[model samples]
Target chain A: MPVTKMIEPILPVEKLTYLENFGHSLRAASYLYKPSSADEIFDVFKVAKQNHLTVTLRGAGRSYNDAALNGAGIIMDLTRMNKILDWNPETGMITVEPGVTLEKLWQHVLPDGWWPPVVSGTMTTTLGGCLGMNIHGKNNYRMGPIGEHVQEFTALLPTGAVMTCSPEKNGDLFYSMISGMGMLGVFTSITLKMKRVYSGLLRVKAYPVSNLHNHLNEIFLAAPDHDYTVGWLDATAGGSGMGRGQIHAAKYLHEGEDPDPQKTLRVEYQTLPATMFGFFPKASIHYFMTPFFNNPGVKLVNTAKYIAGLRKGEHLQSHAAFHFLLDYVPNWELGYGKNGLIQYQSFLPKETAEATWNEILTISQKKGMPSYLGVTKRHRPDKFLLSHAVDGFSLALDFKITIGSRDKMYAMLQDFDRIVLQAGGRFYFAKNSETSSETALQFLGEETVKRFKALKHRTDPDNLLESNLYRRVFGS
Target chain B: MPSTNRNSATPLKPGKCAIIVGSAKGLGGALARKLAREGFVLGLVDRNSELLVQLCAEINAGNVGQAFPYVQDVTSYEEVPALFQKILVDLGGLDTFIYVAGILLPTTPTTYDFEKDRLMISVNALGALAWFNVVAPVFQALHSGHIVGISSVAGDRGRVGNPGYNSSKAALTTYLEALRNRLSRYGVHVLTVKPGFMDTDMLKSSPRTFWVVSPEQAAEDVYKALRQRRQTIYTLGRWGWIMFIIRHVPSVIFRRLSL
Candidate 1:
């Protein structure tokens, strides 16, 4: 009996050194493997112990850098483990393997009058990755995050054993595993709490605000009563018209609101398009319709989009629109053309927002490139390891990606990062790409980092995994 | 850089979850995993989807906190607010929110660029304020939590390199001061982190620096400050001292110096 056959399906074991990352920008060459079972996971760990090879896990291949790419070690692919074991609508709980995508879970449970309690920005994110990341969704103000709703899970401990963890049993490991970002162990199957929904259609109101205060105070106050909410700040506007932008808030209107008899027969929220996962980024630049904005004046077209939104008969399909809204407007980012695109977002403490915004805008004038649009919103930070949220305001900007961008953006990023840090605020990692590693450590600290390394050693003592980001932050 | 036993040297274990907003591959990312090893979970918030998902998964395998990755323009009130609410349900609420999300415009010395100025303000100051409005109530209501913001030496006064960033940081510092004063009574600790020069991807992409500290080291300092609840912490410690003098410098002397 060769010890690697039955367990072989759990993980793909390949002795290669030059493993490239998801973004195709970072590469690590060592060993690659994909494990689909708990025993196989342990076997991979056992091999690493015997071979003294570092280890790292791979999911969906959605990460930008090297989180899933283990160099000079084993890259365990959890994709094949995708499975939905159990789902109970009454209890609002569902169980599945780590590889399950929120999209897949939607297909299994949405039709049964249940929805994943919360979803990340995208549908393709894996359940294990979601649990590892403790993802939050559009209804965060009321629902919180994915970790909050998780009831229990089975994670392969770094000690080469499978353990069950939750708030009650091995609660510490449960908390650690849910938000640990794979530092604690590999999650095999997890039971997630779900949410109740009345219908598949959502009625959204897109109203405009003129300044930051209203956007924060008025908008966030209505989170609980509303099922879904979001607002946009005009980064290009200022002075008396600070928050003069759009706020698009939505909620499921219930079946009675629509009164469509055809919708009454168990309207199942359709699964997201598979291509969406593969089509992560479609557009390059955030350019306005130059043809419309420039308007050569020769062609007369009646486009009243600048005035208000929606036509006479139009409502969004809750399941399809929210997750696939960007998909409908395909290649919208391409409007910026050759310059590419730049998307920026920042968060500041509530207290000094007015003054800090003034200073930042005062400085922004120096940069030749400026955003045409902006949006402001509120965020409540979660406990998931490196989450980015706080009691404050967040503003986003879109620009044409350009050549001097690195320098142009870094200067502002540095200043903005420093300001938020000093103001008892933090930045959003999802929207950033140029923050310096040194500054990154400053915000988190070195001691905490060391503990992370030690924990990794204790869990996977043999070091069988690696990722681009892992090497970047912990390689030394 | 040599590793430090963060708890022994400073304070705090590594089992908490930290939210780093501007953490794709810089200071925010460094702090994210640093704390992850410290036994803390990671919640990475950023607009860069590619970077956000990848980074979160990497950290997930290393720790137990179940790093959650959220993609939203931090500045977008609709996107981030909803994200936070979802996080509340997902991660079981707040432990710490590390505000590292920000953007840099061109460094020219002109205020005529209306668009650039607007972005600077929106991304730097307004976004920060929006986040605060949402989390303050949560932390205050819970009666315990921490709000850590990343500030800079440039914010002390109008800097020559980029006045927009200088002003943004200045505003952030002042805002946090006010927020700390208000939220302290409710058991929410507010920490202001200031670093002189950080060796992040941003710095690596730019000119080499002698004073720059690696993102990992910077992350350690942040964790230290959070554990100790140091209200106003400078990552390198010495940076605080350096800025102390710089802040008090009169306009005449300060403006005259090339620094």
Candidate 2:
């Protein structure tokens, strides 16, 4: 009788390293392996199964918390697998590898008069990560999440099964896995339907709003007419000025609107300037902004911005300039320092948005750790199983973390969660890091949580897929 | 680097490679000798150059198994990657990774020394995490390896006397449990040893002590557990029952007395 030998995968153990989230707040040590193909990913799964190590799927590590972190486990970095497989300019449909970033996708299709239907504030996020989190753009109220724009995807499960999922085929898996936070499987390829655009420019109008009521009202009213609308709140402002800020509403320019559509729609015109005023380097801007990360300094900057908005101006801005404001200054998040920053974003119903946000802002200021920056946007609910949207408004607040302020800040955030939950609000996993298991269950409902867990068990019988965020919120 | 075949007259018996971190003194040093006697090619690592060199020489002189000395500070997390790779190359192959490096600075409820508390957390908890991160993936790939973490019984409950020590152990204990959960499917054995009182400098500052055993005796228990593939164990055995009672004590009443 001939004996068959079992061969173990040859892992690159020297590749053990550290990985951090986008905000740089949460970090973990893991063995990072960049697999170039679905076959390599399968080998990784085989290795992880044999070694009893959980595997986390990572694309650009753009999450705000531990969603991409798996401590003392294996991190499968898909960035190397980036390749645009197919594109059809006529149909506005494109197929790309999971690691293809929004920046790469937009740059490739923009000259052809197509843009990603939805994108986050930063374009560096990967397609797999976006679908995993089901990110939304300023136009969320109109287009829904990026998942709604996805046509289909191929995923590799832990059970060594390759599944092709779409709305019509394996519908439950499609709806659940889109916002599943990379728990079900690894996305190998994604086919997305891009939004067709006539021109690159958007007619943007900026005006200042007064108090919490006007901020919410103005955005709700403007969203109906504009393709994209967002508000910047002066968190430092108190009393009648609470939630007072500026609103910028933008509308897409028709084909005939731009005198030279070819010139305006070119990638060169759509790209942000490499330098501010064409002299000072944009990459170094964050170092100078560091001095203003504190409460007093941010208050001064917010006041100046509000004062500048009082003039109420209108201008034509490119698509990149309008959508990717977070990337305007390179490494801008570094201004928050080594402790980094955490964002608390909540989605509330229109009926209770004003009242609930008012209480949250008041409590934040009262705690003496007011958020450095606040942004508000209108949104409509989607059908994703773990949706964080509502037919109302969403507020995102950025809090700078200091050596001694973490505990206090977390306590305050828990209080904010209580107020939001009472007002029937929901939380996004991609942002907020301090959400407790009970809060997740309350917002997602017992049925939804149970169903997601059931699907997870069925797909990953050995529980090979997991991340820090999944463990923290799901409490499994 | 030091190596010798002092027992050249006797046939050498080498089974598998094992690395004992903080093997310069105490339970770590004892465990190093025990594994060596069991024919494990050893990689003994510690920050104390003098003690580490002496231990390495002693092991080589015995010639039961070969030993390599690596001097490294456990708190220097960034340097772990290079040293980990070097140790793997020197050992040819690894089958067991034992993380016994730790520190216990005197802490009291009355005086809060941030520096001391920080050092304890750094060495006792975070340092272990850094080393474990390097070894886990290799073991997972091989599908057969042993990981042993030497935690303390102090982690069972938050005692008042040594706040930092108790909390660091608690964190380490919880982390090991999580690792066990993650690595169990691969047939990897993760052993968390929660020893009670051991005769070492670490416990000399305690207000009181009982059931203290020599490092040699404790090593015997640990080696037995490692061979048996036990998930967890309390050295001296009775500490398990004692901690059970201490853990269940209602906090409202347990707060009145220091264990």
Highest DockQ, which number?
2
Q: List the residue pairs that clash in candidate 2.
A: A51-B140, A52-B186
Q: What lDDT tens digits, residue by residue, belong to model 2 across residues A93-156?
A: 9999999999999999999988899989999999999999999999999999999999999999
The candidate scoring highest on lDDT is: 2
Candidate 1 positional error at A157, Å: 2.4
Task: Please give, for residues B178-235, the per-residue lDDT of candidate 1 as tens digits.
Answer: 9999999978899988887787644543343557777788888888888888889886
TM-score of each: 0.54, 0.68
RMSD of each predicted structure = 24.0, 17.9
List the candidate 2 regions with Cα displacement exceeding 4 Å.
Answer: A1-12, B1-259
Q: CA lDDT of B13 in candidate 2?
A: 18
Tell me the number of clashing residue pairs for each predicted model.
Answer: 221, 2
| lDDT at A180, model 1 | 58
